[model samples]
Structures are given as C-alpha cells and as structure tokens.
Target: MTTIEKALIRLHEVDAQSRGDFLLQTLDARAKVIVTIAYIAVVLSFSLTSFSGILLFAVFPIVSASMSGISYGQVFLRSMIALPFIAFVGIFNPIFEREPMLVAGDLTISRGWVEFLSIMLRGVLTVQAALLLIASTGFQRVCRALGCLGVPQIFTTQLMLIYRYIYVLINEAIRMDRARRSRSYGRRHYDLSMWATFVGQLLVRSVGRAERIHRAMLARGFDGHVRILGHLRWSSTDTAYCILWIGLFIAGRFFDLSSVLKFL
Candidate 1:
C-alpha cells in the first residue's frame, strides 16, 4: 500500500484502540491527562546521571499500556520517530564530561555516557507514555480534558485542528501525487521547478479546502470552544486511578525504589 494509506490505517488503528473497552478507556479523560502530565514531570525531574532512579518511571507506561490493551511493540516502533532527534541532541554529552563513572574489569564508562543514556531512556519513556495516552484516550477527549483543566482554549482548539488537518493534508498530497504520476508519462522524477510548482499548487488547494471547511463549521454553529459529546464525570474509580498513579509518581521521583529493594 501507499504511504498515505499506511498512515490512514495507523490513524484508524489508534482510534479503534481508544474506543475499545479497556482499563484506561473507562476512566475519565481528565484523569488520564493529569496522570500523564504528572508522569512526564516526574520523568523530567530526574538528574542527568540518575539513570537507575529514572528507570523506575518505565513502570508507569508499561503497566498503563498493558492495562489499556495497547501493544507495546507498536508504541515502541512509533516512538522511534523521535529517537534520532533525541540522539542527535544528546550526542555531545560524551565529549563534554570524561569523568569515569563506572569501571568494569579495566573498562571505564564516563559520566557523559551515563548522562546520554539517561536522556535517551527518559525520552523513550515519555514518548511511550504519550503514545499510550493517545491510543487509550482519543485525542479529541484529551484536548477537551486539557481545556477543562484550564489550558487555554485556543491552544487546545488549534491542537485538535492541526491533528485533524493532517489527514486532509495527506489526502490532498496523495491526490497531487497521483496526478503528477499520471502526467509524468513513465518519467519517474520531476525537475526542481516542477516540484516547486507542485508545492505551490498543493498550498493553494489546501488553503481553498481549509476555507471550505471553516465555512462549513461556521454554518454549523462553530463556536470557539471544543465540545465533545457527553459530560466528563469523575467517578470514584477515576479518583482512585489518579491518586494511585500520582502517588506512585511522587514516590518514584523522590526515592530510588531499586536501591530500596536492594537494601531490603
């Protein structure tokens, strides 16, 4: 299948997962959002060299994904998209700090390397947590939850629009690609000028399409607020869920559970 088709399939898969009857799917979206935010904050609060301390944070995403029936392999594979950039951003750590942190049979590992690894681990964990959230609780619900949590309406609205607009953008690109291929007459590649023209045409088409979409929304009483169907009732289960996870997060952040276990 084509790239766009694959992307659309992935999008549908996430939607299906979100709608599935699972542990997290049953909880209020606000609870999930708040817990996710707390998870990220705790993950980021670890020191650069405290890799072992931060390793405990992985439990949150792993348990969450498992309870929610989300596939760990899919989340890990999808989260790899951010790995290269994360690696690039941390690649210089080894050069800046050469102090030996660990010694194993004459081989020495530097503090910089530890820091780099810690950064990489943190990024992977946080990305997985985010992917799990979107897969478990639909993005629309998450955005609505954010707005309800006092996040600016404009930001949440734009985030929702940008997410939805991606499908439209990709569909438009697919149409343009098909047209380009049909007119290429067996010629595989287009010149720079032709590619530039295609880009400009795509932009024009996208703008026109967006305008039509906006008009349709306005016609349907499009208020600036994001309105999801049904009320978000925070039940006792949601309260327990939030309390349990947030408490775990706080404990994980302040104490090295691994060390405590070792001592025990």
Candidate 2:
C-alpha cells in the first residue's frame, strides 16, 4: 500500500477504536486508568523464567477486547506495531544466556529462550491491554483520566493538544500528497529533494495554522486548565468492575493455571 493510503487506513482504525459502545467504554476514566495500571503492574511482576501464569493472564485482554467491541484483528494489528522495538530490546537474551532452565525427559529448554519468550509475552500482554484501553475509552477520556490520576496538568494538556491537532496536520499532508499526485503523472512517488521541500513547506504551513488556531482559542477564553473532566465519583459499578478484574489479576499473579489444571 502507498504511504498516504496507510496513513489514512491507520487513522480510520483509530476512529473505529474511539467510537465503540461497550461496558469498558462507559466506565469512569479514572477507574479505568487505575485498573489498567494495576493490571500492567501485575503482568510485569512475573519472574523471567516463570511462564503459564502470565499466559493465563491473556484472559484480561481477550475479555476486555470482547467487552470493548474491538475485534481480535484490530488489536493484533495495532499491538504488532510495538513488536519491532521490543524485539530490539530483547534480541540479546538468547545469545547471552544459554544455560538450561527447564527439562522434560530429553527435551531441555535454555534459559535464554525462556527469558526471550517471557519478554515477548509480556510485551504482547502490555500492548494489547493498552490498545484495549485506548479503544474502549478513546483519547479524550484518556487525557481526562490521566489528569484525574494526578498526572501533571501540563503533560495532559500538551498530549490533548497534540492529539487534537494531529488530525489537522494529517489532513494537510493528505492535501499535499494529492497535489503531488496530480502534478506527477509518470511517477507518483516524489524524489528525496521533493520530499525535503514538501517537509519544509509542511512545517511552515503547520506552524502558521497552529498559531492562528491558538490565537482563536485565546480570543474565545481558552483557559490553561482542562475543563473536560468534571468531578468523578467512584460509583458502585466502578467499584465492582475493579473488584472482579483485579481479583482475577491477583489470583493469576500467584498461581499458575496450567499447574492447577493438571491437578483437576
């Protein structure tokens, strides 16, 4: 696919994630943020050589995605985006540690592979959990949640501004891409020089547009504080939601499901 097409497709996928009608989507932002943080902490607490229990924790994402109306494909595709960076970080595990960690009959598993798989599994869990959060709660609520969770207002405001304007910047890029396509009949792709010029012009245009928007906001009484989040009380439903999931998380943290199932 073309670069412009890929950008538009990703934007569409993001839009889909933001518009679902699901239980997770209806929860208080602060509750969701707190629970997500707790879930992630539990997922990461497992030892590197340990397995199975962490895999059992996959239920969180699957159930969450189901509740959030997010398809497996959507979560998988979005989650895969982080694989490269995680791979880069964990790539040296197998090379550096080759001692045997587990053995079954003639089958011996090296600590390196075990640690490597553990890292990848942890990455997948965290990524899916985060994507589920964004998909269910959307970006605006996420900002509100962070502010309510005592994250710096400055950080939340900047994040909100960036997310709000990113669409405008992308639309500007689309216009430029269309303009380029119209002018270049034989070759749709621009040369490196053309790209450089396009980027410089895009930067200039973006700055001017942003300045105008900022002034307009200021003229309309744009206060520095985020007024998006009202006073949120922890409702009974929110309490129940946390209890059910965090209970499961705590249970999974201490027990390996596979081992338990072997007894049954």
Candidate 3:
C-alpha cells in the first residue's frame, strides 16, 4: 500500500482505540482533559537544569498507558514523530554554548547539551501527555471537555471542524491518487506537471466538498455548537485522579528529587 493508505489506516486504528472501553476512556472527558492540561503545565515548569526531576514525570504516561490498555510500544512509536522537529531546533545548542556546566573526573558536560536534553525531555512529556489525551478521549469529547472548561465554543467548534476537514481531505487525496495511478501506464511517481494538475484539481474538489458539508451542517442546525450523546459526570475516582496527578505535578515543580537522591 501507498504512504497515504498507510496513514489513513493508522488514523482509523487510533480512532478505534479511542472509543474502546478502557480505564482512561471510561473517565469523564473533562477530568481527563483537565489532568492532561495540568500534567503538561507541570512538565513545562521544570528548570532547565532539571534532568532527573523531569525524568520522574515519565510515570504519568506510564500509569496512563497501563490503565488505559494502550500499548507502550504504540504510544512510544507515535511520540517519536515529533522528535525530528525537536532535533532541528535543538541541534544548535551544543555548538553555540560550549561552557562546561558540570565535571565528573576527566569528563566534562556543557550547559548547552544539558539544556538541549532538558528541552527534549519537556517535549516528549508534553507530546505524550497530549497524545494520551486525544488517543484516550477522542476528538469530539475533547471539544466537549474544553467547552466545559470554559474555552470559547467557537474555538472548539473550529478545532473539531478542522480535524474533520483534514480527515476528509486525506480520503479525497487518496482516492484521487488511486485514480491517477490506475490510469498511468507504467509511471511509478507523478511528474511536476502531474503534481500541479493534481493540486489544482484537489483545490477545486475541496471547495465543492466544503460547500456541501456546510449546507449539510446548516440543514442540521449546526449553530457553532456540537452536541454528542451522554453526559459527563465527575465521579469520586475522577476527582482523585485529578488530585493525584496534579499533586505529583506540583511536587515535581517544587521539589527536585534528584537532589534528594544525591543527598541521601
């Protein structure tokens, strides 16, 4: 299968997983969303010199994956996609700032390298926290949770629409490409001219599809709000879930466990 086909399959698989009756999926969307936000906030609040303390935050995702019935391999693989961007932004740190921050016997480590690793840890933590949220809660309920959290309805509506639009757009692209491939005599790849034609056709088709979708929404009375079935309840477990994670996050932000370890 082609790259687009594989991507579509992965997308569908993730969607399927989100709807599963696992631990995290069973919780209130608002509670999960709030905990995710708080988790990310704490992850970002760590000092740049904090490597060991930040490492402790990995427990959050570990526990989440364990309870949520989502495989660690799957989450780890998905999380790696964002690493290239971090590498691009962070690759310069070691070169620009060469001053040594720490020394151990004959070995020395520069402050720049330390900062780069710190940034990478933060990126990974935040990304996993986000991926866990979407993978466990799905998109629609995430928006519902955001709405409950006092986010503007218009913003969440647009976010959901964009997600749905991109999904449809990918399907359109896959179909168009397949049609082109079927007509091609022996060509393995499209030429520049073919790409130009493909994009032009895609644009036109996308416009038409958008219009159709808009009309359908209007017919259904989509007035800047999306309502899904079932109500979100804040059970005692959800309250404890929030308190436990947030408490850990706050502890992470204030206390450096690495120092404690070294002291001991």
What TM-score do all the candidates reach, one by one?
A: 0.89, 0.89, 0.88
lDDT of 1 by residue, 201-222 (tens): 9899889988998899899999
Q: Write the per-residue lDDT of candidate 3 for residues 1-264, one digit (tens) a residue.
A: 888888888778768878998889899999898898888888887778777888888989988987788987788778888889997898798899799998999999998899889888888888888888888988888888888889998898788888778788899999999999999986878999999999999999999988998899899997866776887888999999889889878877787766777866
Whole-model Cα lDDT per candidate?
0.88, 0.83, 0.86
| Candidate 1: residue 178 Cα off by (Å) | 2.6
User: Residue by residue across 1-264, what tens digits does model 2's lDDT show?
Assistant: 467668767767766777777787778877788788999999999998776778888888888888888787678777888888888888798889999999999998889888888888889889998888887887878888788788899999999988878788888888888888778985866799999999999999998998998899899898876566366567899999999989988888876766887887
The Cα RMSD in angstroms, rounded to one decimal, for candidate 1 relative to the true structure is: 2.4
Supply the global lDDT for candidate 1.
Answer: 0.88
Colliding pairs, model 1: none
Global Cα lDDT for candidate 3: 0.86
Score candidate 3 by TM-score against the native: 0.88
What's the CA RMSD for each of the models? 2.4, 2.4, 2.5
In candidate 1, position 70 carries an lDDT of 84
